[model samples]
Target chain A: MSATCHPSDELLVAYGAGSLDEAASLLVATHLALCPRCRAEVGRIEAMGGAVIETLPPSDLGADALASVLARLDQLPGAPMPRSPVVAAPGLPSPLRDYLPASLEALPWKRLAAGIEQAILLQARGIRARLLRIGAGIVVPEHGHGGMELTMVLQGGFTDSGTGYARGDVAMADQQVVHSPAADGGETCLCLAVTHGPLKLTGLVGRLVNPFLDL
Target chain B: MPDKRLAVEPGPGAERFSDLLSAVAQYGDRQAFALLFQYYAPRLKTYMRKLGAEDAVAEELAQEAMLAVWRKAASFDPGRANAGTWIFAIARNLRIDMLRKEKRPEIDFDDPELVPDPAPRADEVMATQQSESRVRAAMSGLSAEQTEVVTLSFYEDTPHAEIAARLKIPLGTVKSRLRLAMKRIRSELGDDQP
Candidate 1:
């Protein structure tokens, strides 16, 4: 029940390992920003990481390495610099102004379903990303990954295969699974999706769009 | 037998504190910068090594992560996150940069090189292993459920309700187990707690 909204242990472990991608990383970052107990647990894992470092026999460091770093450090004159308030604290994310590439935020969103709209974010090097916003209660077409698909919930909640996902939950799918996803009727569901291949659409319309989507 | 994408992490988490430190270092804080540098160097080294960096490359990246710390200390915020997590994130980002260069095959989960890391040292892991042995020796002192609860909490960092669900026990039962386990570990570690 709670798990429908929570990330599993493996996901957290992947996050700790730094194996997650940027889009999903954003989702998790947003989640970790708000959850305190999880924060402490992550801190403990970090402490464990430190303890691991302690057990390793000291490997020899390069002669010039320490000196080089010290030199670079010395070159940095101590000065108070301009800071972003959001960057400094856990409040609102930085206004979408600073980071979003203009092309990404400015895309024309197309209605894909009732209360659901999607805009392609960017495509390069055989990877395509899209920003999808689903109003509460909107249900997306049932689909599965063609190769591999990584989905991160940025805001609101989405129910896929009857499982609900809120902000920070990452849903991963490969060719082996097929399921339809819907959002809860409570909030707007925002997600960043990264797809390397294509998505297999389960419905009739999906069959038509599938050809175009195959890139 | 493998899906094409290299996506492994299927959940949420991030490093706001480190982002701040990077921003702050961009500003200027001498004292804060030094403190940041001192903390992350070893981790950066460890991370670089995991990325298949020779010792030289690993050492350089370690210095780079710390240098960023020195330059960006002014931006460090006590509120967002402490120095350690912030720096750890910085080092991790640096590790990612090195890893992308390895061009390692995507599906080979066995690539020790691709083990995404918070940049922990192998020695440090060995210490935890030793502590695990000590903890095991100490565990005989508690009931079976107490051992399970302590392991899940300390190792998994699971939520109370979740732990209950995981163990197929009542929430209250899980709490009791935790309480007993803590009492035992405390008495065992007594002065070691300091």
Candidate 2:
């Protein structure tokens, strides 16, 4: 199903402008793979980018610039016409496919608690992206965020504060929101989550688990 | 000396560039490629400079972007995008790779799981075709404040928060301004397809 919840227009604009950090970009790209609406939104923004470029006054390149580029054109091999399509891995979105193995079952998951497991996909520039798998009917410890946290459900669903998020839905949380999300009893919920800063666990169980969690 | 006859002037229209690009794709037309290089290389360099690249690096990246245009011309679909939009995407991807050295994972159009957009009406198809001019016209209509935010957001490498800081405004205001600007642009472009 298409996502009901999406990243804010501002966030999608940033992604279109190519200003978002790598981790955040990855999560949004994965979401775009599942949401055509956001893809169309980004396309319009990119057309604006083209308009911006068209209006920009030209800068002066070196006098030999054209000559030099022309010289090198002959040296480079001709690329095949109409570029080949990439073979996407089954059951995974195209953006996430490269970072993950073929199947979720093959992931080397690290258990954070009795029913919660996480596998970090990437960490760079203070942004961490991970796949979170919460067992059915389990409640994650109550937590606030140090900065922005973006979660997109990949499989099954979860609920927080009367809001239901199923496959392809995104949940955006920041320092102001302290929530304990529970996975639906139907199936284990698998999510791709990217966080800009540390998640602050606030509950007594969370406080106890935080010391060992390193998240 | 290079043949002076091959130097085609970049005309004052976007469709002409699209045709030139198509010629480059159909046959290895060096003259058409040269005209494109003449028009776009300098603008691409300016784009790089605005993103904080030094002169040398900007020049190199601009050249690289042009080289990529030559290599990837066959993939350019004139029905979907004009030359400027296609080249902007190329330059943006190159910046992500060469400047930031970060991976911006992309959706594969061929992926089976991808949700297809609703079929477009005949008028929607026409609007899509004229999106370049529509965007330019809409951009001209933006308020000066909205224009500044839109320009800086696209041209500068700074984050939205930084744009707020630079403008001495709150981040919320920056976001709202951008949202309003996009709304205006979208309305003008008739982009409310959904």
Task: State TM-scores per candidate.
Answer: 0.57, 0.92
Q: All models, DockQ values? A: 0.08, 0.67
Clashes of each: 21, 0
A42 Cα displacement, candidate 2 (Å):
0.4
lDDT of 2: 0.83
CAPRI quality band, candidate 1: incorrect
List, in the given order, the native-contact fraction of each candidate: 0.09, 0.71
Report lDDT (Cα) of residue A22, candidate 2. 83
**TM-score of chain A, model number 2:** 0.93
Error of 2 at B67 (Å): 0.5
* C-alpha lDDT of candidate 1 relative to the true structure: 0.51
Docking class of 2: medium
Query: On residues B64-174, what C-alpha lDDT tens digit does candidate 1 reach at each position?
Result: 777766654654444433445445555655565664431111111122212122333354342332242343345557787775664455223224556678789997787
